[model samples]
Target chain A: MTQNAAPPPKLILRFTIIGLVIAILATAFAYVGGWLDPGRLTPDRMINTLEDNAGVHEGYRRNHAKGYCVVGSFESNGNVDSLSRATVFETGRVSPLIGRLAIPGGDPHANDGMPPIRSFALQFQLPNDEQWRTAMNAMPVFPVSTPQAFWELLKASQPDSQSGKPDPAKMAAFFAGHPETKPFLAWAKTAQRSSSFVNVEYNSLDAFRFIDAGGTTHFVRWGLVPEAPFTPMTEAQKQDPDFLSRDLRERLDKGPQRWHLIVTVANPGDPTDDATLAWPADRRQIDAGIVTIDRAQDQADGPCRDINYDPLVLPDGIAGSDDPLLSARSAAYSESYNRRTREEAESATSSTQEPRS
Target chain B: MNPRTAGTFSLPARLLHWLMAIMILTMLFVGVGMVATVSERHVWLVQLHKPLGIAILALVIVRLLVRWRYGTPALPADLPPWQRAAAHLSHWALYALMLAMPLIGWTMLSAGGYPVTLFAGVTLPDLVSPSPTLYSALRFAHTWLALSLFALILLHLAAALYHALIRRDGVLASMTRSRKQP
Candidate 1:
């Protein structure tokens, strides 16, 4: 009688199976449409996509091409052990850090005063063969969540081949289909333009997991909170073509610039997968340590020039969350790294030939 | 029924009680610790926190089932009516918090466009659409719920201590001591 009475379990199981079938089919459809996974969006393809939007440079990265390298140290405050078991968090653990501060563009010679997003990337070497790497941007959130959407964003932003001008209709269509892009557009429209890279806060919008010694995990995103206040450029300061790089050089000459490494944790169920969604501002935060940049150099001759700063090269206690963008980034960075090196090789051969002639 | 012998709980009840006790305590500490840091460690703690919460949620379902199948022992005959009501209300509140907290967290993440990864390679389906406003409201609620759960846990612990140490009542033993043992 009881078995006959309760149909809910069987009903639920049937619906669960049906749901699974639908999900599998939907994923298959998205995959076939080339609108889900990043595997098809090869590094070369991504670079080419960016180049299509903005003409490419010969020997520079396809994006964030204009940059200056900095040598720095990350001083760990030892308050991190309870959250992650990484050696980078050991108190007083001083790690030599190399970073590049850059502005977003395909043009290596883009004017420094142009209003654009800034980027900061760091590689940290820890004891016991551990390493931590991250790439960050001044924007709080990226425009899209997936690699496919990123491609679409570039495509939409690209000038029509015939008209030689970006179509507003195409961008509007893209925004209509992908409403998530609206917040980013709103941010871009309203964001205060920072005058200098040192004063800008850079965020790792993708979420990551911090595993502690007891195997406890938390979802987190990090931001480099600049110690220098946001100093808007005067009209006179804006006239300098190399204002940012030049300002950083003069500032480093006087004293080391610093930023507090602030890591914000998502409460249980906080989004860890999407880069386009910014967590609520009041989420729990921790100022893990300080980053001090003592020296700056030209990107062409700098130690960081060859490094990819892949976010996936994580430490023992840290792991990338299921953020699809994280793996896409690693793939894209590798492509950028490889292409630049190959171009550098060709440029080197061409330069030597010129001297010989 | 003999009062002393009636103090024992069903074996499944006692086992689930102790297991859930440890899990809840660990989860509370882990939740607090997760909020306290933004270090590289916060990532792993987050990874650990999701699955642990889900496990607690899953176990609580079974626990509720077990509670229904094998009814709880009656309170001590001499216990005050108010005390008995408090005990009953607190137990249900803990169960509600345990169940609601994980579900709220899951829904919140769904709204925020984040996946609720149970652990490495396993992700649970999101329970809601991505909406920033909904995500914010849920996140705020999740924090307050956690704080509320924390307060209730302390009250429960204090009451348990009252029964075990001061009153010499066997109410605590109903869940703590196994029926199979002498």
Candidate 2:
């Protein structure tokens, strides 16, 4: 038995060597077949290539048609400096843009007027020579920092653990997990109590790089100051919840509702990397430009509602800061986009097939 | 000849299995790490993340071809039918995910209108339209799938360990070491 086992061990050894060689050969073949190209996997390069190809295919035309394209149109006005000064670089590009407006609840039709913080993600196309840019959520800070924190928050904020209704205790647990959100929590809590008059100021919570004409760089935060004065909503106003939307609609109907898009430059000497801290209002307020909203068009009926807003889309001059959140966002956004599109394509194909009699 | 012991896996099968195992595991680890450490300062990780993903993508294709040409080894006769089915299903899912994740990532990057560079400045062609909404949904799916894949792998490992140590079956040894009997 020992003699027989020894011969088997040698055979096994020979087989292992051959297996290793085969694997090496297989990997080599794959590498040469364009399957191993790293460029295809890297976020930045992948985005750039996608954008360039989209440009050729005119795929972004619908995105541009959305209101965000107005940023690029401003360039034709020869007011690039004024535009640069007043706006966050993310809001300045004219690339096709995508925005998602959600009710912040599991239900699609959850009360729209519940003082939910409306998220606005703008993907602006940079000029031919510029990098891409994306601006998001009105707050300069997010509720959570890490993915685990985000998960915790989601778990807490999710409707009743069993019933699927908003669970206050869970929400509290989420808040407790991250003490840093005290300021944001305070703001959200207060805002939720207010009526139609609630003053919602969007913060560009992430820091971004702004390259000036002289090639000097400044890290900046963008703040949106509605031209209209602040009005706090009453309890009655919350009952009618669509009041904010109606207000926006009424203002747009009366005339283009405008907001002063202000850029607060980071003090070069101070160099604060975290966006949670607000730049003191005393910081020089550069007039980037007026963001004029031509009466709230029926976005429900428009192409704007259908597009995605990815932060990685930067025009040439405006570049993303080395924010890990930005990279994660970019990667996550890319993955989401692919899956959705594939599903859409699949559904479309299925729909087009002839039905069984 | 040792009649009591079972025959081992062929050379090509064992090599493909381990090579793919290392690459897949590395890719999963890198992916989780990348998502977890998202800060502007971690540009180096981002750089490493993309290339590693591409490497996994490349290796998966080769693994698939080899798998196709030479099928997996048959299970031990003592192995239960359900366990065998579970093993096959899990392997197929892993293969599918290995292929799908990179392809989706590549297309998503393309749609965002960015260049896909590997390492020392090489770039790949675009694969889709630059749609932000599309990018977001795909990104979400990618993360979710990755999480699922991680869970599946854990289960796979648990099962293998159970068979190897508890059952004292030769299942794990088939892949870990050569199975050629004299």
Candidate models: Cα lDDT each: 0.76, 0.53
Report the lDDT tens digits of candidate 1 across residue range A1-357: 112222233455555554565466445534533446445554456777888877867657788888988999999998776898888888888998989999887778877777568899998966643558899999989899887788888888898988976798998999999988877888998787677889999999999999998899989999999999997766876788788888898889899999999989998877788888899989989989999999998887786766667787677788888887776676566556545655665556567631100
lDDT (Cα, tens digit) per residue for candidate 2, span A1-357 = 233222333555555554565466446534532346552233333333333322222222211211221111221222345333323343434333333323332232335565355554444433332333444554546765443454455445545436745577767776776786776776666554323211455566777776666666678767666667666666676677466556555554676544555667777654344444556667776766555545333443343433445565544345567545666565545433444355444444568742110
Q: Give the top-scoring candidate (DockQ).
A: 2
Model 2 TM-score, 2 decimals: 0.55
Error of 2 at A150 (Å): 2.3
- For candidate 2, the clash count comes to 77
In model 2, which regions exceed 4 Å deviation? A1-11, A17-106, A129-133, A192-199, A213-216, A234-237, A241-243, A268-272, A295-301, A352-357, B1-182
The regions of model 1 sitting more than 4 angstroms off are: A1-39, A160-165, A349-357, B1-182
Docking class of 2: incorrect
Question: lDDT per residue, candidate 1, B20-129, as tens digits?
Answer: 88897677666654443323333455667889999999999999998899888887776668988998999899999999998998997676545455644356776886
Provide fnat values for all models in the order shown. Answer: 0.00, 0.09
Error of 2 at B99 (Å): 16
Candidate 2 at residue A343, lDDT? Answer: 48
Task: After the best TM-score superposition of candidate 2, give how far the Cα of residue A206 lies from its true spot, in angstroms.
Answer: 1.2
